[model samples]
Target: QVCPGVTPPTGAVKVTPGHSPQDLALARAHGLPLLSVIADDGTLRPPGGGWLQ
Candidate 1:
């Protein structure tokens, strides 16, 4: 997953531990946001809170 302000290289794909489709689907079904990193204040990073209701 990409950091809040970090730039990833071209064609870069952040593969975290639970990036599988099954895991994603499961998290989606449960209304949970999938996250790889968080802010220093404990806030979920981008692409993470989107799944939250």
Candidate 2:
């Protein structure tokens, strides 16, 4: 965990392992900053961060 104790960034999505790249791209194009791409083992990772304010 990079920042274990720190609060998670707002507007973050914990994506499942099966989420498609097309969905990811759409989210990004629509300004979805915080993308949580899941691994095969159900591990969640933050690829980027976005501001909702």
Candidate 3:
């Protein structure tokens, strides 16, 4: 966990596994920065029409 008054290194990327639209919406509503990452055909994908559907 990141400590208060401390900053992570540059170009740091944080990911949340198994994220869904409802989860994304709720996170956004609460002003949380979240990006959906999904697994497809042995690869990872970002949020899209198929993800939302």
Candidate 4:
């Protein structure tokens, strides 16, 4: 379910636990994987284990 005050533009949400605190909470609550795709420098990091390949 979406967060209480959040309204997704597409009427759907993409969980990004590594980048968003709200998403992290949602991911943890749903036992979803936490993946990091961007580095601290704001660049796309190499895909790990073919996660985004």
Give each model's whole-structure lDDT. 0.61, 0.53, 0.55, 0.73
TM-score of each: 0.33, 0.29, 0.30, 0.45
Candidate order, lDDT descending:
4, 1, 3, 2
lDDT of 1 by residue, 1-53 (tens): 44565555355444443658866766778677566756678777666655652
Order the candidate numbers by TM-score, best to worst: 4, 1, 3, 2
User: Total backbone clashes of model 1?
Assistant: 0
lDDT value for model 1:
0.61
Q: How much lDDT does candidate 2 score?
A: 0.53
lDDT, candidate 1, residue 39? 67
Residue 45 lDDT in candidate 1 = 67
Q: Candidate 3 lDDT, tens digit per residue, 5-46?
A: 546535543434235667666666767765545465645565
Which stretches of model 4 miss by more than 4 angstroms?
A: 1-12, 38-53
Pick the lDDT winner: 4
Q: Which candidate is the best by TM-score?
A: 4
In angstroms, the error of model 1 at 12 is 32
Error of 2 at 40 (Å): 12
Question: Which portions of model 3 show Cα errors greater than 4 Å?
Answer: 1-18, 35-53
Instruction: Report the candidate with higher lDDT, 2 versus 3.
Output: 3
Q: What is the C-alpha RMSD of each candidate to the true structure, in Å?
A: 12.2, 12.5, 8.4, 6.6
Backbone clash count for every predicted candidate, in the order shown: 0, 0, 0, 0
Query: Candidate 2, which segments miss by more than 4 Å at Cα?
Result: 1-18, 37-53
**Predicted candidate 2 versus true structure: per-residue lDDT over 2-27, tens digit per residue:** 44555764555554333777767766
For model 4, how does the per-residue alpha-carbon lDDT over 1-53 read when each residue is reduced to its tens digit?
Answer: 55777655347767878778998899999998776767787666767524654
Better of 2 and 4 by lDDT: 4
TM-score of 2: 0.29
